[model samples]
Target chain A: MSLPHAILTALLEKPSSGLELTRRFDRSIGYFWSATHQQIYRELGKLEQAGHIRALPAPTPARGQKKEYEVLPAGRAELTEWVARSEDPKPLRSALLLRMRAAAVVGAPGMREELRRHLDLHRRQLEEYRAIEVRDFPPARRESEPDRLRHLVLRGGIDLERFWVEWLTQALGELER
Target chain B: MSLPHAILTALLEKPSSGLELTRRFDRSIGYFWSATHQQIYRELGKLEQAGHIRALPAPTPARGQKKEYEVLPAGRAELTEWVARSEDPKPLRSALLLRMRAAAVVGAPGMREELRRHLDLHRRQLEEYRAIEVRDFPPARRESEPDRLRHLVLRGGIDLERFWVEWLTQALGELER
Candidate 1:
């Protein structure tokens, strides 16, 4: 459900071919709402068929060739409505947390290493996010409304990674004790 | 995949009827990894067929009647192996964050209220988790290994809720400005 809207959002930001969309997803939008390249391509077709988007005029629109897409009025209206729509926060579903609980019953001796591994991963992610912040959002620069909102989203990612790094460290300590 | 293992963990903690398992999931396990009663029941049947679990002796044992289940040795072995397995953490996929990013493009006028609503929800959830912490993990109590691991899981839930609360409040502030 959100994937279509995610695609619509990315398209509204800028017209892009499917390949460009996939690449952007891997870099930016996917940080929060991930979609595989296949899913993105599939959704692009559905959006086009639904008249929410259209392929830009190209020299040759042949099969298997890249086709650029831009959001139509319908797509923009739908996305705007979705922004105001009420949706409940989905329940947390972490397989790692579930595994930790399962280990409680089974007494997993190997989970210590697993927790360590997760710690390393979160640390790396947090570092990458911090780097982006320093590069893109240095202080003393006036930001537009969109820039402010986008920076806030990046902050969310940084904070979430920090949470995991701290929690996993605590979990590993619990295991050691 | 994790649902079956979650069922096995619950059964190993205490043999229970399908009805009872569903209730427990709603109360505790569902907080982290939620499943509908229908899915729980379906998995119960599959686990039984797979010989990972078995029904306990009951007087009636009729169809549609309650059937108690306990994990078998094979199930325990499987769960133990699963606990030792390494799995990467799944990427975050949050609709609210996506909505925020979308709103940045479309200029959602109504998103201010939406952020407020989420802030309230996260606040309530955080309070609920804190209440559970007070009731279950008293400071003076000496916890066993299993209890420690279980407490860690609960802490994960609490910290996550807190993260949302903080982030949503910040988002609202940004919108206000």
Candidate 2:
């Protein structure tokens, strides 16, 4: 469901080929909603068949022919309806947490070790998020509206990571004792 | 990788049957990792065969039987290894952001509606988080360590959602102009 929505949403911005959608997914959508290249390709075919999108023939620039796609009116209407509807709250899906919950039952020693390891992982994530923020939105270049929006999203990522690290730290401390 | 690890980690906490593991996954691990009951059952069998976990004979109830599983030493070593190592950051996977990025390309009108919709969603999430915090950790219960940790995670969720709504609000304001 999300995959089709993502593709239509992408086309709504502008028409692009399956390949272009894959690239955009990597650079931007991957930040939040990840789809494999295979998944994107598969969905494009499905959407096109459903008439939610139309593929336009592209002239070969040099050696390769690329097909571009645009959201059809039906696609736009579907997307609009989706946007207007309420969404269910999807739960967080982290493997690490599953392990932690099980650890409580396993015994303290092993659980303690696992918690320590998670703490280190969270720390690394916090560092990486910070780096992405600096790389993606250097303060000097954050003057435009889009840049500002990007910065805000980046900040949310950084803050969430920081919180995880802090929680892991505190949890580790408790387990150590 | 995550599936087996999740099962093994849970077993390490305490040996449990597939039924118990599913319940635990719903209550706690559900916050991070989610899996269907079918997946859990399949993985448990795989883990036992792979020598990562062991299934003990079911206690004689003289009627129905359910086998309990414990993580083997090999499993413990694996979990520890995973904890100690740096996890490759999972790609940012967000559907909402993909929509926003696509909106940017499509032109302002549609994008504005998308942003407004997202903002409303985030605002509602923030409220939900607050309600969970209050319900889970009333002021009197806040002094416990576990409660505090739970509260912290909830607070983080609340803050992140709030940040998103605020940013979307501002972004929408500009896009409307």
Candidate 3:
């Protein structure tokens, strides 16, 4: 449900071909809302049919040609309406924590190794987010409304990865003791 | 997927009727993984059919009878295997962050109110976590492995609420500027 609206928002920011949207999702939108390329393409078709979005004329007519898309006025209105609606916060589903709970019951054999694996993964992701932060939102940069908002989203990712690294370390320490 | 495993974990901790399981989920399991009462009943039926769980014979039988469930040895083995498997950490999907992004483009009318509401909600949750920490996890008490694991999960909730409160405060400050 949110995915369609997310796509609409992205297209409103910039008209993009399906391929371009897929790449953008991997780099940006994927940070918060991940979608496989197939899912994105399928949603694009739905949005086009629903009158929320429209495909630009193909430069070359072909069966498998990529098509560009832009949000219609309806899409913008829908996004605006959706923005104003209040949504309840849902608790994030964490597989690691669930495993921890299960490990407590079944005995945490081999779990220490998995916890360490998670630690390494989070560390790499933390570095990746930090590199992005340094590259994109350097000091002295004039921030626009959209830029500031995007930076906040990036901050969410950075903070979350840091939390994981910290918590996983604590877990490992506890497991070893 | 994880829901069944979570149910298994809870059942292993204590055998409970379906209705009891629903209430437990709203309090404890609900912290990390949430499920509606209907989903719980449906999964209970499936789990029974799959031989992972079995319904305990009731002393009295009648319409709308409450059914108790217990995990079988097969269920315990399955949960143990699941606990040891490596799982990829999912990207945290946040509707609030999505709303913030949409607000940046669509104009955030009335969004300040929502942000303030989130702040208060998180504040209350943070306090509740702290209270639990003080009451149950008092440092004077010696801890067992299960106790420590539960505490770690509690810490996850506490840390996450703290993060939200901090981030929301920062976000509100930015909005006011």
Candidate 1 residue pairs in clash (backbone atoms < 3 Å): none
Winner on DockQ between 1 and 3 is 1
The residue ranges of model 2 lying beyond 4 angstroms of the native Cα positions read A59-64, A95-177, B59-64, B99-177
DockQ of 2: 0.26
Q: Write the per-residue lDDT of candidate 1 for residues A24-115, one digit (tens) a residue.
A: 99889999998888999899999999999999998997998889999999999999999899999899899999999999899969999999
**lDDT, candidate 2, A1-177, per-residue tens:** 678887887777668887888998776555577788899988998999999998775565433467788889998877766644445446556544444444433433455565566667767767876888778778786777656655655655665566667766766765565
* The candidate that achieves the highest DockQ relative to the unseen native structure: 1
What is the TM-score (0 to 1) of chain A in model 3? 0.94
What CA RMSD would you report for each candidate? 1.2, 6.2, 1.6
**Which is better, 1 or 3, measured by lDDT?**
1
Clashes of 1: 0
Query: Judged by DockQ cut-offs, is candidate 3 incorrect, acceptable, medium or high?
Result: medium
- Candidate 1 — which residues are off by over 4 angstroms? A140-142
DockQ (Cα-based) for each candidate: 0.88, 0.26, 0.72
Tens-digit lDDT string for candidate 3 (A41-60): 99999988889999888879
